[model samples]
Target: MGKPTGFLEYKREAPQKKDPFERTKNWQEFQLFMPEDKLRQQGARCMDCAIPFCQAGTTMAGSGEIGCPVYNLIPEWNDLVYRGKWREALDRLHKTNNFPEFTGRVCPAPCEGSCTVALNGDPVTIKSIEYHIVERGFQEGWIQPEPPKTRTGKHVAVVGSGPAGLAAAAQLNKAGHTVTVFERDDRIGGLLTYGIPDVKLANEVVERRVQLLEAEGITFKTEVEIGVDITAEELETSFDAVILATGATKPREVQAPGKELNGIHYAMDFLTANTKSLLNSQLADGEFISAKGKHVIVIGGGDTGADCITTSIRHGAASVIQFDINKQKGAMRSGDNVWPLYPIIHTVEDAHKEAMAVYGKDPRSYMLQTKAFFGNQDGQVTGLQTVEVTTELKNGQKIRTEIPGTERTWKADLILLAIGFTGPEQELLQQLGIETTSRTTVKAPYGKYTTSKPGIFAAGDNRRGQSLVVWAIHEGREAARECDRYLMGSTRLP
Candidate 1:
């Protein structure tokens, strides 16, 4: 709140992005940094509302009424940034979020959705300001490793190096406990390193944070899986506390005719392979599922679906199309979509924009459901059959009905499933002897994060199903606080 009238005077100015066609030429990040003067102006647009629902971080109305799950000190940081207190702004940012850079880049920013200013006009540039604060902190050398002065002599084992596991390890180490993170992959940063493409989140950004965690005394052991490389019994005996953040790697699939076609693959498998290959040899290793010169059909219309389209276009796919089971949303919010809730409106994503620039049209087809797949004698997928459907929102539930005589075949050589995930894989959970919910997530209550087995805790997608990265960070921090109390009969973490 630098100036009381700043919200009205200074209109929202988003950071410039590289041309879609130009950015697709390579895998480099497309977003360019905003000027410092403009960032300060954007921060001043924060209206000092009495009750900032921006940080409510709760669900309401069985609706999408959610906000910043990490509950960052939004107003404080906004004010600090407006007043040019760059270092102080970074401090307020880190007070709530362990990894602002990741959230700043990838988070949907429910904080903006729930901002009071959005009731009339645009919300403050909360996400951009947060991103710049941490980036500036690193550039100005304000961020550095500060190892705990004393050791508690307790050991913690975190299985997974994703956002949640890393957050838990960071907090546990801050409390003077020895923390060791185990990842099945050769490199650390589970989903961050592989699930997400480097175009959206560069590899170096993750590596920078990992290096800092190492300097702060947290240990990361890659290529060592708990259920395979190391026994769960060994983990139980070796550490005072154990955290399961392996995430929901189980990909949701469609059970249609000819589903076993060779070209059909899970979105994560495609993204992971592409990222790994890119890092290893800029995709020269031919280790990834290439969309080059092939017709790609992606199912599911969520963030992952968007990513699949973007990645395919970057790979020089001949034709790319996305199928969405739900009907297309409107540009404006519906009557049911009230304030403080995430506005249910349609907006073109960067991925769609890129697709349009390359394909000369948006690649998304709405209200379409898969029926079956068609494959050649060689077992390679050739196309898919789908039926047009109508959707209705009855009593806040989506009811989809397939229309008769609307089934049609669409040609495709490659299909990527981006629907979502069922829950965490059961192998590690079973080996650890921990109880899971009916949905397959570990049976850890929200806020309490306690599993069936004593001394065992779970968080992130493993505990909450597939969700935003910010929520994973929130649960990880809270779990660490609870784990610390369990280890020492009391806790100093916040």
Candidate 2:
């Protein structure tokens, strides 16, 4: 420990964010970097807990609450960074996580919540320090492709190039296996390049990582649909093992009166199209989904919804209204969600802050229910008919009841549906004859990713449904280990 008592001496310092008014004008990340010395001081705040729960990654007994799923060695890395050992810190981070940049930028940082320091004052700025370590690694040319010394005869095929798919391919390639990642999109990285907004994660970060993976001898095939272009049985015979990291791509739909309006779009479609159009000139032409000078109504108050709000504000939207069906959460942790659990608190992310700057108040409206979508002459969505609703549990079922005399209408030219996804797309999964569970996720046992058929494995969102990028990376690594063991009767991978 560089400074054993540094936690007492220094106050918690996070990355400074740009002013809301100034930041909303441009589509870029708002979090300004902290000085190196200040970051080191923040790193020094990691107390020497007897049992570090930050890295435990275990679900609490009877509660089902878990720590970091990738099992990050939090304290070790924090101490390394605190001691000014940047190279060593990067090495330690890469031990468990293949992509810290991705997680550091967007991860909710449950590790901080479970930290011992969080019980009293502020927790260690673990995520910021992590971001610095990885970013410096690239700047210092420490991050390089590590081609396997010896080539194993085994060949493996990884479907999807998101976090999970990339992790699996990286590990498998490192283990001397010829790895090929198949992506349906034009770009190699799946959601990383499309679903997430560039303001959150710039496209260059994803491209750089993909380039490293390519340098490491992993072949990537973009714009190729697996089931439609390539058959499952063909993959079975072609590659010794096939790893299905095809994420949950199907968007959940909202049933309303005028659901078939022209202006209504799924969040993924909106976000993906925007990023795609920005990247390629071909797609940028013709009526791009612009929110400029228009009132935008975003449904579903999740991360994707926040992203939509932020993106719309960046597009010079006149106003934005974010709606959530659930009640507003408390400022502090609730009774049901105690210590060490990822607390469900009222969080105003960067998007909400931007919206507040543009509009008078925060754009979030809780307990708001959409009664119907009103369309114009050409079947284009013009407004949303909504009502205030109360939730109740009756006869072992939960329901939402509309409040009397509370019907209202909000003008909206663009309506983005940011409600969560509903498992993986069925056409490809069904065509491959893979069985899905009741929740529609691929039927695969936890920890062991083997499907009903031998030599077929599934992981990530396809297996666990829509989840965090960290969980997807964890699942990918686990599935890779299982697939390796299944193929060669043993594996050295963790």
Candidate 3:
């Protein structure tokens, strides 16, 4: 898109990050700005493929996400950045993504995974270029509140202040509709403000975008929950349309012996409290579950597990280890992990780097499954028992087996469960008589987003279960478009 031989001339150089040991001491973001020249060089790596799978927005045959869920104009922006047109690149970015800042920080970069350049070596630094584009836009004062010229006089009540709700609110407001977002938490940015660790998606980043949304005339109400503070009937009578963006927060609990130990905590509970306490009084509140001076063991593996390890290290844990039930992936992609599909390979995350710097080794124990938890006489957790597992393919399905005589016990005072989530909470769904799938997520088709009753819609994690922030934003925008159509019999949202 930029230069024909750019991919061949330049090697991939990821955006610079703060030193692991130093950054872990504080909760500030670890990602540093890249110089514009370096960014342009990376942008030039975007080879003009006959068909760029990076923006396909569809899942190929893979074990992971294949492309960008938001379907970002990746090549266009890449070319723009290569040409040093920062403002035009930003405009292209904002056309598809409501919040590039969030995705750039937190998304796993499936776009990079499916890049045409990635077919051989590394992909273009699309994520960093996107981040720099938006941040530069903010720095140059190109991004300001552009409130709609006229109001539709239609009211939209959005539940949850997470990415999905915020996207819906923003888009609806752009269409000149009055939108009010209701959040049960004390603050806005549901998962953005709480679920993620600050070192990854800093709270300030979220607050800044939320403030811009407020300036654009979207109303946000905190500590106000639907089905508790206000009834579903009351909401239907008050607002013209309702959108439940309440995320899939019901965490999957570990089923093991002695599970009721005092030190066991859900990942979100620990992360939320840590961020809250950090923001409230720089953690002086002592309101969060601390890993200080304690041996910590995190169950499950993924972003959440890594987050737990990083947080534990920051809290000055004596020692930390993570348990993963699956076998470790290879360094390179397997044959089945074909091109355009997300490569299933092992990679080190920021948490692993920090933990390695602190513990002298990787904090992960693959193929180990937690068997039981052990509690002391005081009902506080002392440790946990785990066993080695062997996995094999059987009739196109994976079969797991416990290895005999491979059971081991590890000492730990704090155990954090980062397994995953089941689905959204059921209070509002039940109250509103909305049907859910077998997965317990809200029953709404992907594009339509209509619930059992008209004027009531569902989107984001509540409808799609646990997914990426970009996907949540996509659904939020789509749902708002549908809601607009329902209200006005026509729509212009994209």
Candidate 3 residue-wise lDDT at 349: 89
What candidate 1 gets wrong by more than 4 Å, as runs, is: 392-398
lDDT of each: 0.92, 0.87, 0.91
TM match of model 1 to true structure: 0.98
Against the true structure, candidate 2 reaches a TM-score of 0.96
Q: Give lDDT tens digits, candidate 1, residues 1-494.
A: 56888898899988899998889899998888999899889988988778998988888856785678888889889888889999999999999999999998999999999998899999988888888999999999999998999999999999999999999999999999999999999999998999888999998999999999999999999999898988999999999999989899999879799989899999999999999999999999999999999999999999998889888998999999999998889988888788888888888998999999999999999989999999999999999999999998898778989999999999999999999999999988888889988888899999989999999999999999999888889999999999999999999899
Score candidate 3 by TM-score against the native: 0.98
**Worst 10 contiguous positions by lDDT, candidate 3:** 58-67
lDDT of 2 at 230: 92
Backbone clashes for every candidate come to 0, 0, 0
Q: For residues 1-494, could you state the per-residue lDDT of candidate 2 as single tens digits?
A: 67889889999889898998898766677778778888888988998678887877767644445568899888888888888899999999999999999998999888877888888888788888889889989989999989999888999999999989999999898888999999989997788889898888988999999999999999999988898889877877899998899999888889889989988989888898888887776335633588889889999989999999988887888889999988999999888677777667898888888888888789999888888999889998899899998988677466999889988999999999998989988777776688899989999998999887788899999999999999999999999999889877899999
Candidate 3: regions farther than 4 A off: 61-64, 392-398
Ordered by TM-score, highest first, the candidates read 1, 3, 2
Model 2: residue 479 alpha-carbon error in angstroms: 0.5
Winner on lDDT between 1 and 2 is 1
Q: Which parts of model 2 have CA positions greater than 4 angstroms off?
A: 60-64, 282-287, 392-398
Worst 10 residues of 1 by lDDT: 58-67
